[model samples]
Target: MGQREQVATSLAAAVGEEIGALLAPVDAELLRHYPGDPATRQPVHTVYVPGDTFTAGTVRSWGDQALAALDEHAPDAASLAAVLGLAGELAEPVYARVRAKLEREPVEDLRVDFEDGYGHRPDAEEDEAAARAARLIAEADRAGTAAPYTGIRMKCLEAPVRDRGIRTLDVFLSGLMEAGGLPGGLVLTLPKVTYAEQVTAMVRLLEAFEAAHGLAPGRLGFEIQIETGQAILAADGTATVARMIRAAGGRATGLHYGTFDYSACLGVSAAYQASDHPAADHAKAIMQVAAAGTGVRVSDGSTNVLPVGPAERVHEAWRLHYGLTRRALARAYYQGWDMHPGHLPTRYAAVFAFYREGYEQAAARLARYADRAGGDVLDEPATARALAGHLLRGLDCGALDPDEVATATEGLTRADLEGFAVPRPGV
Candidate 1:
């Protein structure tokens, strides 16, 4: 070879060696961080009840209440029956399935709130509440009435409430562990988090709790509530959600939006505070961006308008809640908060409708994309992922059965469906 060609060849070989040396270890570590499949138990809604009133039977009671309301004001006999999961000649079966699912699993998640819902209870009452919560948890575990997702929401870590919050957490967790050794799928909610330091402090506190109680090191996970403006935009004008997650040291499982508090912090009028307000939407978007692919779930805030009056008025409330939920779903938020039991029917209905409406088209496209047989329409990787995610979520939520999804996607295997969320590197 000529001298110049020989030199070029040698330089290329050296560069290749250096690149391999630099990236091989990093790539291996990256594999460790690769988020596996999303959690199977993605609850469509979290129902919050005040600590004092929460009981093992609270969830089922709420389901009963929702069913009663549906029986009374679901427009007609067919609609009412549909809500009960019965098949009918109605144009849509989504609401019926949702109603039936709610009746079966009315509260997929329950948050015993010590914050706004519980307010500042006296120390004696707080202790009693904690004890009662433990009893209820134990009873639910024995009876199989416990929700798949269960937790407590402590007051914010702000100066005035920080001590109270920590004390409540200690009392509740201590009682819970003693009674039942920690119920399955437990999570804690920390509200109004405005700083990453708060998340770090909570993580350390959880570690201490685990050590003291002989629990596993990472047995507990908590969610950060993005309520105030500071949470979305730090005092120094930097985005703070990702920082907060990092501060949690991998203990952060979710980021939840708080509607009124978030909007109020932005100086919005109380009359205008809502889950769909522009400010709330912007905060949710930021949360989605920050938590994406981190295995940190994002949940939308609740609508304050509750159905609690005459039949006509209750229908209005249902309509409003359905609209707001649809908006959240369109933005890809699969989970939300439901403050009142009455919100249950609409919550599930909106979610089921969203999935049902898009099922056929999504399944067709996913099948075509999977086989690399795009006859007329080109399918991108993102589109395929979105379709797969939809089917997976539908299956998880009971909106669609495995047989339905499999048939729609032309005999796609379960493994094939799961691969959509976390695709193989080159397929």
Candidate 2:
């Protein structure tokens, strides 16, 4: 295998083994982070809204409430400061955290996943579903208030059979973009994916939409959800996910681990506690493998269980998940979910960890490579090979940054290449 392929294979295998061992005792609740595509330069952040809660009337109500609250309280404020505070308070800590995230970092993209109609048929109650989606698109067009974040979610399909999902995706995304007036950078979130063929079907639909709309052929992008038992059970789950993305017109921009469905696939109970279990690792690893160097971001699933208790328990519980999430983010897994506002700290914590670890490790590894290269003009082939392997692994894991990677890899002679060709121990 080529270096990139080798690294991807090793990563997937290592993660699989690690998770297998970790989840042997528990039933597959171990949440694993998927490093996003190496080509993507932007930070990924997605905030989910319950689909059922954001119908036309409900969304209008939310906007109206903010306007009313501001009018009643601080009409003179440039923005809705008074309403911001009240809404901020009423808004879960998670929402406040999301807003804070906007202030603290450049969240390159945003995805709002409505809880209900996503990946399923629109209920009869959604008489104005198409109209509502069009309105959302138009609102997105205004773009004055909503952060330039991409609005995405699985929309209801009108088709009655198995093809309904993709058909729904086609109908909804077309309407959403045309009526909702999404920006050029919009991506569609495809939910409940079971195989590559399903994604391919959607890709065909997207292509047709693009042609009809006079847009670029690949403008219709996707963020896939790996939530099925068949997906998790595949021995080459990572490879399968990669194939699915490729088959889907190669327009996958992101991958999200579906915690609830994944948990159910593992036959675990439906309690909120199921999200963080080790079983989640398998699905996430598959997504990561698929994303390798493709610029497709991979996201870990959300924590379904909310910490509702004494301040101490909430703090401690959140602290643990925060640490876990930080590890994932630093390794290039940019986004995860926050079911409630309380998990905001974890999100910020992830951003801090990435920069801190990236800079520190880059400095250290570059220094070490410099010392070795400067001191030994006649370094033994075996030693050089081992060092090369070490650098390769380190760079892959974000233990070293771009400059360090360049320095460590510079001036590699043919003899050094000979040695490097020989697989190093534990590589």
Report backbone clashes per prediction. 1, 19
TM per candidate:
0.90, 0.60
- How much does candidate 1 score in TM-score? 0.90
> Mind giving the per-residue lDDT tens digits that candidate 2 earns over 1-427?
6666433333667899898888675542111122222322343446555444544233333334333332333333223222222223223432333343434332334455543434344554332453455456557456443434455565423244445444445555666666644465465677777777778777777788778778777776777787776654456634667677667655777778877877877788776434457677656776776665455678877765554466446545555556657656644466776655444434543444344334444334434453554442445544544444444433333334456455444544334433453432212
lDDT of 1 by residue, 277-329 (tens): 89998999999988876678899999888899997678778888888888899
Runs of candidate 1 with Cα error greater than 4 angstroms are: 1-13, 23-37, 75-92, 423-427
TM-score of 2: 0.60
Q: What lDDT, from 0 to 1, does candidate 1 have? A: 0.83
Worst 10 residues of 2 by lDDT: 28-37
Error of 1 at 424 (Å): 6.1
Cand. 2 Cα-lDDT: 0.52
